[model samples]
Target: MKAPQGVTLVDHPLVQHKLTRLRDRNTSTKTFRELVREIATLLCYEVTRDLALTQREVETPLEVTTAPEIAGKKLVFASILRAGEGMLEGMLNLVPSARVAHVGLYRDPQTRAAVEYYFKVSESLAERQVIVIDPMLATGVSARAALERLKEAGARDLRFVCILAAPEGIEALRGDHPDVPIWCAGIDRGLDDHGYIVPGLGDAGDRLYGTR
Candidate 1:
């Protein structure tokens, strides 16, 4: 399926290969966690490709030269609760200095509506880029809620990153926040009756933590 506007598919060979393994039901929990970290790191690289840079003078043993450095305040990675935590470590591996924010939200099984339990983020969100990381974008309910909260808290620049997405979720997110770009490895056919991505890698949090 064609990706919706404002959405980017990170289909690099390395990412696809890892994703194939991640989808295998026989894969062990340890291996699943490793792949999530590896894929998240790669996805992070793509998401931040357009970050602004400024020139800085650097001195070498033999000579001095101007070098490019990331400009402005450090970026922020907002993890959307328990499942989002799976992507947090890998992203941090790439941007060690980035600030972190957490939005604790869960989907009610019956209604698939997002419920917030906790929320915390770094100050001055308006001055920094905020990327919300969650492994799965099934219903988009939780994601929308998280983004709304972040915006209410002063975030102006925001992006959403997920390992897998359903077309419905993409539409839902774009319907409300067209400006925020979505970066993902793949978009599956559609969601199941229970709001899970069809042919997805399964419950990412459960697979990562060996929990049901």
Candidate 2:
């Protein structure tokens, strides 16, 4: 099904291979972390395709030449806490110069509602491209809430990147943020009874942090 809004489910083979490893229950924590990093790296590659760039004239060893480079302005990474932290290193590896901010949210089990706990954004959010990172998009409530907070903090140009997502969550994001394109490695079938993605890598936070 075509997403009505700005959402992309990356179907690359390498992403699939890594996702498979991430799904296995027997995979060790170290391996899962490594795979998450690898997958995040691949996802970041696509997510930053439209990053702002500026042209600069550089003098080569022999002569001066005009070339394009990332503008003096840096990017801001807004990582949804806990699970999102796992992907931070991967994104940073790709864009080490980028600034990072952390947003903490937790779901209320009784109401299944998101509650914000922490937030810290860079000073100049409006000038930088913002990439919101989270490994799973089960319900998108947390992601949506985080995005709203960022926008309130003056973040405008934004993109969201995730390793795995459910159809419903993707739709929710699209419905709320049609202009902000979402990049996901895979879009899983549906959510389980408890709001987890079906056949999805179970509990990304637990898998990454062993804190179920």
Q: Best candidate per TM-score, number? A: 1
Q: How far is candidate 2 from the true structure (C-alpha RMSD, Å)?
A: 1.4
lDDT for model 1, please: 0.95
Per-residue CA lDDT of model 2 for 133-158, tens digit only, reads 99999988999999989999999998
Model 1 residue runs over 4 Å out of place are none
lDDT of 1 by residue, 1-212 (tens): 66778999998999999999999999999999999999999999999999999999999999999999999999999999898888999999999999999999999988778999999999999999999999999889999999999999999999999999999999999999998999999999998888889999899999999996
Best by lDDT: 1
Task: Give the whole-model CA lDDT for all candidates, comma-separated.
Answer: 0.95, 0.89
Q: Which parts of model 2 are misplaced by more than 4 Å?
A: 1-4
